[model samples]
Target chain A: MSQNLPLPPIALPGQPLAQSPPYAAGPGTYTTQNPTRTVITASVAGIPRVHADKSVSVTRPSPSHPLLLLPEVASTVLARVTRLNPRQATVEIFAIQGGGDGIHGGGDGGCVCEHTFQGVIRAQDVRATEKDRIKMLESFRVGDVVRAVVISLGDQSNYYLSTASNSLGVVVAHSDAGDPLHPINWRQMACARTGIVEERKVAKPI
Target chain B: MTDRRRINGPLEGTIPPVFLTSSTHKSIIKRSPTTLRKIFLKTGLTPPATGSAFLELPTPSTHSTPTLKLTSSVYGPRPLPSSTTFSSNARLTAELKFSPFSTPGRRRGYIRDGVERDLSAQLSIALGKSVAVGKYPKSAIDVFVSVLDCEGGLGDAGDEAGGGVDVGLMSVLATAISCASAAIADAGIECFDLVAGGVAGLVLEQGGVVEEDRVEKSLEVGQDSDDARRGMRKNGKVTLVLDPSPIDGYIILAAAAVGYMAARDELTLVWTKGSMGWDGDSTDEVERIVDGAITASTGVRLVINEAVKERLLLGLKEMGLIRGKAVSGDGDAAMS
Candidate 1:
């Protein structure tokens, strides 16, 4: 029955959707071309929707073009830690999750492009409880995949990221013996093959 | 570095400059002067680019052979480099290049000149307005245009510097704008609307008055700008041309080009050249020039709409949603 739901028409940018006053503009919609006769038009190539509140929007259609993977504030991202210092850890964001509809085609849970974005995790953003005691070496290692939230599109070169919550931190990591790590505690991860414990800011397994 | 081989210039003194001008071969203009030359455009030609398009405009007299040919390619929406400042919106860049053989005479160097740089900057600004740059933040999109042929015989007869000839620049920019928009759409980059570029010029009206005006202008030797005004104010008209060529002989008092988004009825870029009193609070002349440019752009937009719709139909056919028979109509054949 869900498959029987009719799909909305695909809209191109600049296509007129409706007259204003009765229907307000929403995301992917804009009004241009004058001091007279204001017309609501789609600004992105996507599917048009008329919400219950009488606002119109255009959501980017999925399954066509290669997804444009970009990170914005408050969005969860999966990234790999590349370098570290006492002050901050350098990371590269690889994927994004849980934004609204309009991203698709990367085979992953959400959109992933061929390129990656630069990100950083400052020492102060590693945990909420430990304001100053968190060490970069103990929190993350090179090649560890960390789940974090984007705090800000950082100054020029990197997107500021934080792994301060219980659900956010190193989700996948390897021990020195090249063994996969399993969470032992909030601060330690155990390598089952080597029977050795390593320190990491591990995320709670569901 | 090893020495690189280069092309040789034309031999000196084999043909005198006077012989070149005395051939009496006036360019053939077959249609009403205001109509655009026929355009032949096709998309998805460059496999390496995310999207690509090829465009050709044939001389009016020719059957199916193009006198102007250009190609455009679109790339990226990829990550921005770390060295550049981060922007909340996507950065758009455009580049235009003309092959040495594109002109009629002297070969051009491969290095990008000042004119190319200026044109590229204008092109970027024109296209940047039509694209929804905010949708893909922290990224860059680039459009590349290459001109294979040009009108006006620039660089011909050992004029390697390309001095004193600017009539071709407007035509080239107009073609590049329309071509690049199609390439972007082919690349699947989301845009607010497609931008079509057009050109128009102010010329003397056709009549027996040419002889009388020439004699009167010769009698008044010192009033050059005044004479130009007399042509417009008394016996001149604006000819809206979508893709203008230098071969057509016109007084060419002034010319204007515009980048228009037809669906929204917006003018994204307006550029006027020549001294027709446009800058001195002459709102009447300025508005007339702009109006002609917009009318020309509207004609070009009709062609663009059909081309884009054809692309969408091809996509549907490839997806098996439409029958192959319905997709076989070849309306895009070059109508030179």
Candidate 2:
């Protein structure tokens, strides 16, 4: 059966096959109806405490605790709350805005780089990122522009994202190579030459 | 006196019984779930012009009670259009599809939705990096996907704003890489290294969750480039999960591999451990999602590596890369 198989360049744990170990549990510890986490939790041996949290969850939940979502992802993808069931609410992000909006709209207005970020806003703290929220320090609002990196191609309908970066953002009024445009600080920032006011991500170089 | 016996219940619409548990608090408890045998390498298993593979995923644990099952397929390594095609390079096209019965409710039809379209594009980019396209002359390959069944937290059903569960997609892409590698072997196509794909989704808790990250300068940094994360996320969105069935997003993370060199220490270690991580030491589930995605991606990368090895060995056997030179059977010929 393993004849025509693709052998590993470097030996991996489950060398013969990519299959998992089948099972892992320490009697009563694992039998709990819904433990806080999986055996993978203990597997984080040498990783620093802070870095360890970056791993993704397996199929099963830890019973009560839900997974954490990055605020950066939420802010980037313009997510929206579609439904709120007993346990949680469903947020979906549509078009990443000009200035990068998230499903959570829980951060300051900014862009990651060129891509407009659109965050999904289903539940408040469920998966949004706090670390990113602190950096941006802003709340998401309806109509506010947003954008996001398509984190992953999820199951059927929902996609995953992270606005954790500064570049991926919404483009409110995108300017071109030489498009005569002005910021919307005032209703009209009359330019000395053109005397025209437009909406754009005006660079206010500090 | 008539054979027609009408019931009081309206028959216009019928409700179908569904099975596929959601995630539970206890992850260590190994329960007997459904078998996803239909989604694997053995199935049909062939790419059109170049490489192909199938992605098999255990049921998702996001929604109801964590008994989700999924399967994905990838195909590609063909030729490119004259304009887009490189002189010495091959081209790629990716396709992602979901079965109507794959989800909880009746799914939308055969139409390739906008989200799926975008995802396909991303898959192309994600795998493009590892493929030795330049080795091939004017050829294009296509990647195809089909989701058999999705349950519970398996994926997001929220299409309100054109976002879907990304976890499944990434998982499938990883699987596809495996299949593609196999096909590439069958076809004996050259490549830098097989690129692996994985899902990294945040199952956001309600507030109060701290998490963290990597040293690799993000190919796509925030608030930087004009294309922003687009170049970095050139492939497209990877799914993010808030609570189980609650919130979600799409952020795509591709493997930065050029035949082994792409995988770093962190990624290598995680794969060496044998298991993909779901939780480390943080209350925030998102952290695990991030790390999990990366680690799982490593696993996917390895899978691709194996496929590449097989493909290369076979291709070389066919092309005679490893065979001894045409040694003259006779002594005179040998001398000449």
Candidate 3:
């Protein structure tokens, strides 16, 4: 694959990088098939790299490529709870875990976006064990930062997110006295300054 | 008979200030039909935009140089409005506007008029096909082109005497298409190919002798004697010129602007205006005019490719991927 063509260090969009039979297309690259053969081309202007596994990809020079950081289905996102209703909790998604990894890995592991996207956590999707007994107020409150996974790209306005797993719930919250809350267990958080225990869905510490 | 409510100007009418026109204005310089005017293109001018570019056609030595300046900015692949229905592809929109002072004599209105709307639609058509829209589902990409300055032909007296085609606007559209394409490429939008625009026109120079051989060639096309006589009576030598400027002082018979993708060998948009049925077969004339425009676009494509590469080289340098000096040579070495 390396001997196929002398690939330019930087490639413009649509510039062919490698042949598809020996190399598969990866991120920042797409394949186009003609009558004779399939060719992998750079989809963005960036440095084209050929991986050890014979996969060809392009890495954008700028780490903060804005549009490429969009959240997709099954991606873990960190969002702040903005509003609460009888059946759902509205959130503004601020960060997305890079590569959709549940664990926080080192070096470029996540993307913190400038503009937030809207999402919703319905009462039914708050937890997995008790579907009918979930209460929106007890599970989440306004201004609580929660970690969740996108389940569906719902309607025109909001993405449907779920916090059903033990590792996906409120990571940060405040007490009624405006003190920071620390998670004590799966369903409670205590403010050290006020010693006021609050009921909430708590994510297990990584 | 008038009640005083607000302060007003003096009761006596006053004459407006006037200034002398510059005396250094000169006629357009003659260039070959295949040559294109110099173009200066740069990307990433507007910091707030996802991508931006500026284009200028500068004729420094000519006193009466037509000011052709344009800037384009691309925003989004962001979320769509709530009112729009769900879509599996990104929605692309383009808007072209002329600033109030873009033209020389007459001022353009802030409101979008028929000309701006028409150019915007044509720009949208020119850009829509090249983008890989399917990859960005339920998002919107908007391209805005602002014509900062242009050749003064909007309300020129010469336009009425020449053919009805607005050669100035055609050239503006062509430049705008190229500028917007550069901005889109800078935005890192996935596309099959970059689209470059070009314009060509059939110009009739007055008092020039028509070649007898060319006249006989037109006659051989099976046109009636009456048509041949009419064609002969229309005095002047007709020549197809690439990148025609209205400042050239020639009567433009017909003009075509094409948005061409050189790599794919495809034409995304073709706009032609003016009367072309006088001398030769109309269909063949149109085809020739379009062919000329494609040739001009291919020339523009080379410049666009160089500009894109220059920016990429700068990016790679900043990222420390390639070391100082000998940038191009080092880029290849580092990648390999």
All-Cα superposition RMSD per candidate: 7.2, 27.5, 5.2
Residue A3 lDDT (model 2): 33
Each candidate's chain A: what TM-score? 0.81, 0.25, 0.90
Two-chain DockQ for each candidate model: 0.26, 0.01, 0.50
lDDT, residue A84, candidate 2: 36
**In model 1, what are the clashing residue pairs, if there are any?**
B105-B156
- For all candidates, the clash counts are 1, 172, 0
* TM-score to native of every candidate shown: 0.76, 0.35, 0.86
Top of the candidates by lDDT: 3
TM-score of model number 1? 0.76
Per-chain TM-score of candidate 2, chain B: 0.48
Cα lDDT tens digits, model 2, B287-316, are 445454555455555544454344333332
Between candidates 1 and 3, the one scoring higher on TM-score is: 3
Candidate 2 chain A, poorest ten consecutive residues by summed lDDT: A42-51
In the range B288-324, model 1's lDDT, one tens digit per residue, is: 7788888887787777656655665455444333334
Which residue segments of model 1 deviate by more than 4 Å? A1-10, A19-27, A31-39, A47-64, A100-109, A184-186, B1-26, B47-51, B59-64, B134-138, B152-166, B187-191, B204-242, B249-251, B275-283, B313-336
How far is B179's C-alpha from truth in model 3 (Å)? 0.6
Off by over 4 Å in 3: A1-5, A63-67, A100-107, B1-15, B22-26, B59-64, B155-158, B205-237, B277-280, B321-336
Better of 2 and 3 by DockQ: 3
Name the candidate, 1 or 2, with the larger lDDT value. 1
Q: CA lDDT, every prediction? A: 0.72, 0.34, 0.79
